[model samples]
Target: MTTTALGIREYKRGLTDLGNGAYAWLQPDGGWGWSNAGLVVDGDESLLVDTLFDKYLTAEMLGAMQRAEPAAAEIGWLVNTHSNGDHCNGNELVTGAEIVASKACAEEMAHESPAMMAKLMAHAPEMGEVGEFFLHCFGNFAFEGIEQRPPTRTFEGAFDIRVGDKDVHLQQVGPAHTAGDVLAWVPSERLVYTGDILFIEGHPILWAGPVQNWIDACDYIEGLDPALVVPGHGPITDLRGVRAVRDYLVYIRDEARKRYDAGMPVLEAARDISLADYDSWGDAERIAVNTSVLYKEFAGDHGPNDTQALFAMMAQLHKERRG
Candidate 1:
């Protein structure tokens, strides 16, 4: 049977029963359907792994959760897996609850500002159709509405929170995908919410990594053998999904190494490499920047890539692909 795209459908939401008062909202067509946040609730209080990208999106998701397993208002804690706008942007939607995240993620959220995003969007008109098209998909979302509330309670190592009668463990596995990446493990539920650490059937973002650290996270996750692993993006998956990401990492790492050894330029090499195994992965083209980033790490090119340059690189490739 032909597969349906991960979008193009009303985002399916609400909790799937995982036993022990713990449940996860599996967003169908997980690509960009809505932020894949996990919910763990018990008789006394509740805990949210992450929030959606915007108020409208999150509000809808919040309502859905209430419908599936009513009484979400009693939620007491919220944990953001990282600073990526998609994962933590909807903080305002979680009313009356305390928001949480790693210190590094909190710091990264502080680094972004409405003025900066506004400046980027202001030039959208002149960027032509592709630019405007990009804006249309992203610009409608509000950046000004974002209120940067860093995690009130931050921890360097593992932290434990007893959710009513259950034990939910928060592990600090970061500096791999971001400065501070984390995963939520519910012992009783035997489930894991892997933020961007695990991207099933989608192009994994390697923005802040030694790559090997992300690989390590995959290895760590494999050891857990969670029954229902809620990936940062894509459909709910099993351990099989975890292996896909590991294989992608190995594929790209070897491909880039081959090019680097042959003394190929990063950008040109990006276009030339045939990523067949990862071809089905959403935004497979991101392999271009992924290659650039990994090559930079190998060569120690640690110079900062500010917004404009970052935009230019992505925009240029977007234009090329469209043409």
Candidate 2:
């Protein structure tokens, strides 16, 4: 295990046994497409939480889990925390496991397919700076030819299922990180696997939010009083990490609101906002997307975000920061 400057202990890449048959799959320098996943096991039954950005990564994770725990040889259920490609793109590899997700996540996944990603990567060379930024973020992952296997089971609000004698609770706490983000809670183990809800030391990109919903989601996770919190990215943390994320959201929301009231443009506000407090976080350029979403929310625009335009803004901001 390696510790960050902030004193957070980060585990090595692969399965970390969390005792009681709970394991976390961590990818170092958890930024962009490098995401984390979890495995919960009881007796001969096991439930897998999320997947990696591609089949190879997911296959590696599965292999590690199966080697560590015999129950993981055949996952009884695969729970996708959200619809992000990093979390659900490898769903096809789980085989016969009953893939489960939030109703909103399932719908979102239908549109954000691996084929779409492959197409984007194929055209990245022609897109100039935006494409460069895209390649920088996702180039390492293979998107071509991966089948999109959506959820076979979906629910709204909350759902409950069992893995052996332990009960795992699924709570839909989004329209925050994504349209339908879910938190998988193993009540008996006092453990919670938060999708992208908690980015730990990284800046979270708000693809869907009113900001308040994300804050409330953070509160809900805190309310659970979990002993072990496995975040979607970065190291395992407790309520402190959750509050840090919430604080960042609140800071950005208020800062963006002031700029909005002064009639500043979204891109300008994103660039102007002081990130001194969060300077240590990875992917600070995500402020471009977060600020843009907050500006739209302030304007009472509930429309879908112009993704390509956002990526362009992020590319510009990323370049500026690098310089």
Instruction: Pull out the clashing pairs in model 1.
Output: 6-29
Candidate 1 similarity to native, TM-score: 0.88
lDDT of 2: 0.92
* RMSD of each predicted structure: 4.1, 2.6
Clashes of 2: 0
The C-alpha TM-scores of every prediction are 0.88, 0.97
* 288: Cα error in model 1, Å: 2.2
Q: Which regions of candidate 2 are displaced past 4 Å? A: 1-8
Candidate 2 C-alpha lDDT tens digits along 280-323: 89999999999999989998999999999999999999999999
The residue-by-residue lDDT of candidate 1 on 11-64, one tens digit each, is: 356555555566566554555324588888888578888887666677777786
* lDDT values for all models: 0.73, 0.92
User: Whole-model lDDT for model 1 versus the true structure?
Assistant: 0.73
- For model 2, state the Cα shift of residue 237 in Å: 0.8
